[model samples]
Target: MSADIPATYTAARPAATAEVSRQAWLVWLTSERRAARLTVETYGRDLAGFLGFLTRHLGAEPTLADLARLTPADFRGWLAEAAADNLSNATRAKKLSAVKSFLRYVERDHGIAVAAIGLVATPRARKPLPRALTVIDARAIATEIGEVSDVAALQARDTALFTLLYGCGLRISEALSLDRGQAPLPGSDAPLRVMGKGGKTRIVPVLPLAREMMARWVALHWQPAGDAPLFLGARGKRLDAAIAQKSLRTFRRQNGLPEHATPHALRHSFATHLLAQGADLRAIQDLLGHASLSTTQRYTEVDTAQLMAVWRRSHPRA
Candidate 1:
């Protein structure tokens, strides 16, 4: 009877395995009440990896019960072992993230209660200070881009893009993604509409220099369509972030700016300059699309450091 057992079992097994994965994905998607689609997808991939690991190491599929039995200590042991294997902090963090997310999904979807996974404590990553050029360095880089007279159109475009970034504190992605009709510049009473992180929309005031540079670029191109990209590539396509970074690099090299100069440095410079000018921290947070004033407050620290440096140089005391 065992020898006569059907090939149908083998065929049905594959289908059953696929169905289980599909159901796991769906459960992950639908289980969390407030989870974003992207979050669900990320956790789904993580859970899948966890399940795969269980299959390999334990020689049995892990159920919600198996996950519930996991403690923070167990998770930490896994992380420590991974680190001992010379895995980078980033990779180990990603793996732990997958484990933690799976445990949460098991609790939510399978009604299996586990202790809070946050107790596992992810590895602390060093928070690098934001790199922002000094106002003089910013002006020098902008001037270098503007002075590339061999390509008038490209020069105007780069000048306007960097001006919008540094002058108005716009993200490089936001500036590149601007639509043609979104302009005529925000009036003193009205702020410009900007789409920021997580598809949230916010209004930011347009500075005079940003308005003037944009207006000049628009006049030069004369594209009347409302839906056209505010900044375009050679073929009139939306400007790519990589291309903008490359252009900034060329300008940086020509102008002798520091090695850390990047498009984002302009944004950092914007916030730092605003703080130097006594702009409110909350107001700067709104302009820079920072979700928290704490994030914006880093620029205040930058401003404070600069003030201290100046005081040390100018003070009569040694």
Candidate 2:
């Protein structure tokens, strides 16, 4: 949370003491909720914004007692104030959500139910579809990344990385976090364990083609065993994702692929391609390590569009 808005109450100890519950709730979010770093950071900022407003609005530190008596009008005033400060509806909505969550925590931990917060509704926002590459384009990009590099080792490393992006459906961070011990033996069919968002681990089945490429790359490169990084920078440290992103960016630009041709685009293509092949949404969710099935269902939209395109192009009735 930004420290700028402390507009602190004169009774510093009272204010600070009253804030202990918030800290405890944050700890619960970390340990029990397993909230992502960005989620925790955003929630903290939203709560800080609310508390800062209360300091100004109430002319005193807000206690749990103060929170309990807040009417719907008080909530509306807070949203209105945030709007006057030019916070977008999306941001105001997020702030309200954080405040609501904090109050719910207070209710659970301290028996102070701020049920009024439930009356506030979130602002609706348009959801965008995931951008996915066509199967041909995804394969072409991976093949080019492997073959087009100047150095043999670098070529092999990049090939393995891109292959994982497409073949294993790994997020760039997940793929780059791989170590030497993760390299499956040639022709081995064991599943690869990937630690994804929010520190959740999921097992991903390795395609034989992906395994072959990975084994061949390991054979041609350094760090085949022990705990060194599976992919390396020029200095031989664990590879930075920016380098991988840059490599993809350069390849896309040269190959005339769309600008969205990113490492993540490979992952989008992974799920979309799977959905196109009639894979179950639940299975894809498991492979992508998504906590919500709705997140995986976005690929259905992509697949539907592709099906429409094929129908338009190939059907005689069209």
Candidate 3:
């Protein structure tokens, strides 16, 4: 929970000796692989854990040669050690993923065979359903956000941002990255073009309420340029996603909402509410910009569960 990143201590230089390959792998992961900083740190720890186990099992430090010569038994031993240490299935799976990724890189770049790594079975972990807010709670949260402050720009900005999320089913990143032209939510009833994950562009209809809120925010715009950022921070810079998330976190705390009331929940609520109203599954998938219909299918399960709950509450055959 500290402000300092845990991996800062583990950050090291690539040496010309035994650590040369590990450092090279780290460098490639960061530079070319486009891996996040946290990924580099956690993957580094997983590798370190693997090497530490190898040292105890083989009575020495593992060199690149030792890694290339590693057998399936060595990997099984490492997995067994992780299991004995009571690592959760999720943690174990992540560690295994890191190892596999590193070995895959070694195989491709260093010409080292990673057949043993490929044989390792990934640990199965349960996937939790995304927590979505109820329609009343989602609307209440949005209404409450606008009243949080007296500043017109801040109030309008928060209101517009939350409305875009619930009304349009946009990801936080997609919403935050919006320029005025890219996500023009004001003065238009047409579909707004949104660039989602993997550079896929999808056009989503703009709700009238969201458009009205956006009109309020744009009036206080500093530049009034078409291409300027739609949302601005305290200093008039493009709004940081954390600021919006923190605002929601504070709102949830103040209103006695559940812990799962996050910024992303608004998007989930958009989908769940639509599905509950008898929207087509495929249409919901397209509206939410989901590439796979299966991802959108989760809302069906949520709706069905809600239906069963309602039936139980209202049924006379108790």
Note the Cα lDDT for every prediction shown: 0.72, 0.82, 0.81
TM, every model: 0.59, 0.61, 0.62
- Model 1 residue runs over 4 Å out of place are 1-123, 185-190, 307-318
Per-residue lDDT, model 2, residue 304, is: 85
Ranking by lDDT: 2, 3, 1
Cα error of candidate 1 at position 66, Å = 29
Worst 10 residues of 1 by lDDT: 10-19
Q: Which stretches of candidate 2 lie over 4 Å from their true place?
A: 1-122, 310-318
Ranking by TM-score: 3, 2, 1
Model 2, CA-based lDDT: 0.82
On residues 1-318, what C-alpha lDDT tens digit does candidate 1 reach at each position?
266766644332322342264356556567745667776777666556556655655567755555556667756666776778787777777777766655555455445566747687777664556777899988766556777546788888888888877777778898888889885453443567889998988888777767777777887787779998889888889999998888888777877878888888988888887777888889888887888777877777777777798899999993
Winner by TM-score between candidate 3 and candidate 2:
3
Instruction: Answer with 2 or 3, whichever has the higher lDDT.
Output: 2
lDDT by residue (tens digit), candidate 3, 1-318: 355645432232121223566678899989998999998998888987887888888787766567776788889888888889998778889998888887777667555665778677788885766678889999987666876677888998999899889888999898988887655555566788888888999989888888887778777774657688888999878999999998888888888888989889988999999988888999989888999998998888878777798899999994
lDDT of 2 at 76: 87
